[model samples]
Target: MSSRQTEVMPNFEQTLLKKRGSALTDGLSFIAYGAQAIANDEFSKCFAPKPRNKVISYLLKGLKAPLSIAGMGIRYFLLLPIRIFILFGASAGFFIALPIVLRLKSERLKRLLFKLYCKAFLWSWGSKIRYHGKKPVLDEPHIFVSNHTSIIDYIVLSSHGFPHATVAQRQGGIIGYFQKNILKLNGSLNFDRSQKNDRSVIAQKMREHVFNTEKSPLLIFPEGTCVNNEYTVLFHKGAFELGAKVAPVAIKYDKSWADAYWHSRTQTFSSQ
Candidate 1:
């Protein structure tokens, strides 16, 4: 090879090696951080198996085990088919009515349909929602921010009332199709973080959406990621940057029934 080719190849190999090394370092750091968190019982409290104790806890577990097994069996054999039926039935109804809803001029009807659809899906998932506090007025131009624990957070919020717009990451497959269509109807924004300047573009759009009186309030999860409900992480300030009244919505899960946390780094949405 020529001298120029030889020099360029070495530089290219060096750059590739550097990137691999950096990735390895990041992976190690993440593992170390997770290990530290687990050691502190932070992870265990949220995700790890139930803590074993010598007396009351063990007795409680022993008592609960048979009931738990029975419950699981009943759920898998009986409730599972019912839930599946409801889910598909609801989805079919939504899509079937969507075309007719679009042809109508009544925004109220559209919003009502959306809310009902969300409620149906949540019900299929065996979600027992206990919404507290006064519901926000649908006409107001406010920023509704909430803590996000799982993929179902949006569904739960939308069931109460449809936001004019919501910020969500672009997704793929059947989920992506539903997300795109639902958000399109609401004039919501979907962003690809991997794209250049996407955040700034979405931010500008959000500002416009918040100030427009004709549009209803926008919903945002400032956390920007799912966290186990036991603790919170630092929130992104983008939601606050918009010149609109920021209403905080607190969501807590009853861990006795189920854990809603989605560890995205280690699990896919479907798996979770």
Candidate 2:
């Protein structure tokens, strides 16, 4: 080859290598950002395995496998059917009475029915909620903001008869049905987060709801997503933006019996 061609070939190869190196670096940075987003100490504990005891650790380790298997079998064979029956019975009762409840002229009557349903549903799931502090009077418009750890947060709040409208992400299947029908009846707004304009539209509605005394109080999980019960994340400012009296609600789940934190990435709602 000519001297000029030889020199050009080396330069072209160097340029190709530099481009590959740049692309690889960018890929790694993107991965690092994603890791940082979800890998904080508190968040990581959501999926962390239970710690082993130091006393008789070897004996405990030997029994762990059989114990885990037995636990799974008991849950699947014994508890699963009971849970299904309870949920089905509660849902059936709600839907059967919903139409009649809607027809009632009294808003108070409807709210009473809703509260009863919520209590029954929660009871069926074996939730023992001990509420403290003075209950807010439902006569005025107020915004209730709380840290969200699971879907059960809605029922727990509603069971208290706050008469609050919820702002939440749109879900599908059974949850979607409840959000669309039951929650909508109470002026709750569910939005598709994937849509660019949905947030703006929902924010406007929330402001309007807060201003309108005729509407129920607004209930919001300002964190915009569930955090592990161990730690709280920064909240979205939209709830605070609405000029209204904001009452903060705190919910602590008892993890010894069962974990209430919904690990959305790794577990489905039904599975949880």
Candidate 3:
């Protein structure tokens, strides 16, 4: 066979391997979905009302709401110290490890670190994530779009296995400094969303980064601000102009145990 044919054979083999891997993952995912559905059904049946008085049921629900809130408050205060430790510790660790990751040019390691940090951070806050859909294949540049609801929305989404650099607003102060620098190391982009000129420049940069850089995938929450995950806001068409593939991901936090929504106006920086 010619050298060209030999090279083409390897590419064909790689494609076949990818297909098989995807098939196996799909099979396992289906099984997991089936099991989860069964478990949810069983749980609902177990807790379902047993022909009880409607008045009593309503009264109990009324009582449970306040009790649940109080319980969340207690848990938050109890875990305050640990949460603070994780925040600062993870920040420090990320910076310390970032230079090495950059020097080594290891995007995979960066992604793994980001994933672990997000999972740990969310767990500290008493929130657990349950994924329900297939994650987008990030083999090529695809705009990862999701609804913005909470400060921790990024954490939950990153933990869902799509590892991509995110776009965050530029800010000032120590936390902001840390965010700007650390995220920069991980191939994240920042821009001033207020100015139209800046937005135009940022859109151009996004297209270049997604197509030319060949680094990692890009994630952008088109909603300019968090809206408590109630409704989606208008998405900026900047990323869409590139005409790249789009990946839509739905992020839903289990609000039964903890309130994950971050109210920027009322919430203090140290509170969460």
Highest lDDT: which candidate? 2
Q: lDDT, candidate 3, residue 97?
A: 77
Highest TM-score: which candidate? 1
What TM-score does model 3 achieve against the real structure?
0.65
CA lDDT, every model vs. true structure = 0.75, 0.75, 0.66
TM-score of each: 0.74, 0.71, 0.65
- Per-residue CA lDDT of candidate 1, range 1-272, in tens? 11231221234435555675567876775576556555654324444323223442333475687776777789899999999999999989988998898899667787878888888989898888888988777455678898888878878888985634678888887668867877668767899989979988998889888888666568898988777776666689878878788888988877664567787777777876
Candidate 1 shows a clash count of 0
Supply candidate 3's per-residue lDDT for 161. 77
- Residue range 183-206, candidate 2, lDDT tens digits: 898788989978989988988998
Name model 1 segments beyond 4 Å from true.
1-70, 138-140
Error of 2 at 138 (Å): 5.6
Better of 2 and 3 by TM-score: 2
